[model samples]
Structures are given as structure tokens and as C-alpha cells.
Target: DAQAAICMVRGHAAEWNISADKIGFLGFSAGGGVAIASTMSATQMERPNFLCTNFGPSLMPVTVPADAPPLLIMTSADHPNVAAGLVALFMEWKKAGANAEMHIYGDGTGPYELMPETGETTTESWSRQMLQWLKSKRFI
Candidate 1:
């Protein structure tokens, strides 16, 4: 899903007058997993999956830029899958020389949804922190 969205976004970049190199992706939880995977797994402007071939280009380009803007990952410390996945993804990003960041909350009131009613926890506030982080990184 992440790869597909990126392919679609990049395929339409020219329509929006945005550079394919300037487009970036971000997500949380499973979405986060997918975003991280998409960044590491795909080549510059190339869709990571053959499914993206549904869209056309002048020609299939090689060496699509792998380096993306920094990532902001958020998860609960107790959520091993989320924690480990994001951590592993972060390591991969650094190894690939792509910038990345992560925030893990120590089980501070479990399952605080990013919904208005739930009231953002210090953990949930990572969303805000992520925004600041992205701004600090000049990603926004």
C-alpha cells in the first residue's frame, strides 16, 4: 500500500509541478512499517512493486534516488512489533544514509488514539513532536 501510494504520488508529481525527489512519505504503526519499508525497498522514483507499472513513464528509470528526508516514527515501548520494526527501519535508513527519527513512549496509558476525544498523551503527543522534528529537519 505504501509503495503503491508513493508510485502514484511520483507518477503524478509533474502534474502537481513537484519534483519526484522532493516527494516524501510518512505513516504510523502498520502504516509506519510500510513507509519505512517503501523507503528502503524501492529505488529512486521507481515503485518497489511491479504493481506500480500500471502507471507509465517516458522510460523506466534506474537508480531512483534512495535518500529521502528524515523519518519520524512513533510507537509504544511495550509494542514490540511497532518498536522493533521502527527501530530496524531506522537502522536501515541510517545504513542507507537516509535521515530518520523515532519516539517510543514507555507504556504511558496504553492505546491513546490520535482522536480528538482521547486527548493526546505524552506518548500520543509524539505526533506534535514529530511535526516539530520535521520542521527542525526542514522537511515541512
Candidate 2:
């Protein structure tokens, strides 16, 4: 489904005024697992230009592809299993020489909001950090 969505978006890029080369995948929670799976399994034509997973860890074993898309992983340090899984994933990506970045916020668990509910916390800047990662990768 994720690959199909990429295909669909690319197919309609001109009509949507979207840049086909800048297409990316971003998922939160369980959806993040899906995004990773899609990238791992994708053909070159089906792969997203980049991937961002927020508070989501792969539910299955990970084997980083040599051509894996640039990855951005964000989760809370206190989120135990999730934090550990993402760290492992990051390591795998690095091992494969894939481009990857991660942020584990100390002050919270679960997903962080794009904007803070109370005073600002490091976690609240997740979206901004992701954008920076994307820009650094020249995907934006």
C-alpha cells in the first residue's frame, strides 16, 4: 500500500504540482513500522526519497539495504522497547552505510507534538528537527 501510494503520487505529480524527486514517507507509531517495511522491500521505482519514523519501531527483523533511503528516527528515551528498537534500527542503517539520524528526547514518552502543550521541551522540536534532517539531505 505504501509503495502504491508512492506510485500514485508520482503518477500525479504534475497535476498536483508536486516534485516527484522530493517524495518521502513519514509514519508515527505502528504506521512507522509500515514505512520502514515499505522502504526495505521497495524496488528502486517504488522507494521513497527519504523516510521519517516517529515513535515507531519495526515489528519485524531489520536488514538495512545498501540503497536504503535516508532515515530520520525520533522517539523518547524513556519509551524502553521503542527507544531500543529505533536505536538498533539506526545502528543497522549505519552498518549498511545508509544515511540515518536519530533523536531520543529525555523528557517524554510517546509521540511529541509539533508544538508544545506547556513550556517547550526538546521533544517538541521533533518536526523542526526532521525538517532540518530533510534539508541537510537535500530532500526538501
Candidate 3:
């Protein structure tokens, strides 16, 4: 379904007034695992230009492709399983020489929210940080 979506969007890029090369995938929590899976065995036409996984780690073993898209992983340090999984995914990307960046926020232990809550910490700034990363990578 993810590959189908990518193909659909890319195929209609000009009609949609979007650049095919700028297409990316972003998933949160379990959806992140889906995003990762989408890339693992994708053909060139089905691959996203980049991937962002927010507090969502692959549920299964990962095999990073040599031509894997740049990756951005965001999670909270206190969320042991998520943090560890994201770190492992980042390491796999690095081992494959794929561009990857990660942010393990120190203050929280669960999925970060987009809206700021009372006494919010840097975890809420993930969206901004992600935008900066995208810009830096020229993906936007």
C-alpha cells in the first residue's frame, strides 16, 4: 500500500504541482515500522526520497540498503525499547553508508506530542528539528 501510494503520488507529480524527487515518508509509532518495511524491499520507482520515523522503530530485523534514503529518527531516551530500536536502525543505516540522523530527547519517555503541554521540554520541538533536517538535506 505504501509503495502504491508513492507510485501514485510520483506518477501525478506534475498534476499535483509537487516535485517527485521531494517525496518522503513519515510515520509515528507502529506506522513508523510500516514506513521502514516499505523501504526494505522496494524497487527504485517505489522508494521514497527520504524517511522520518518518530518514536517508531522497526518491529523486525532490518537490512539497510546501500542506496537507502536518508533517515531521521526521533525518540525519547527513557523509552528503552523505542530508543534502543531507533538507535539500532540508525546504526544499520550508518553501516550501509546511508545518511541518517537521530534525536534522543532526554526528558520524556513516550511518544512526543506536536502540541506543547504544560512544563514542556525539548521533546515538543521535534517537528521544528525535523524541518531543519529536511532543509539541511535539501529534501524540502
lDDT of 2 by residue, 16-101 (tens): 99898889999988889999998898888788999999988744578998888889998887678888889899999999999899
What would the per-residue lDDT of candidate 3 be over residues 1-140, giving only the tens digit for each residue? 99999999999999999999999999988999999999888888899999999887744579998889999998887778887888889999999999999988765446544334545445557877999999999987
Which of the two candidates, 1 or 3, achieves a greater lDDT against the reference?
3
Ranking by TM-score: 3, 2, 1
| Cα TM-score per model | 0.61, 0.88, 0.89
User: How good is model 2 by TM-score?
Assistant: 0.88
Candidate 3 lDDT score at position 59: 45
Q: Which residue pairs of candidate 3 clash?
A: none
Superior candidate under TM-score, 1 versus 2: 2
lDDT of each: 0.52, 0.83, 0.85
Highest TM-score: give the candidate number.
Answer: 3
Candidate 2, position 109, lDDT: 45
Q: Write the per-residue lDDT of candidate 1 for residues 19-94, one digit (tens) a residue.
A: 6655566554445444544655665565432111100111111222335545555556665655665566556556
- Where is model 3 more than 4 Å wrong at Cα? 107-109, 112-123
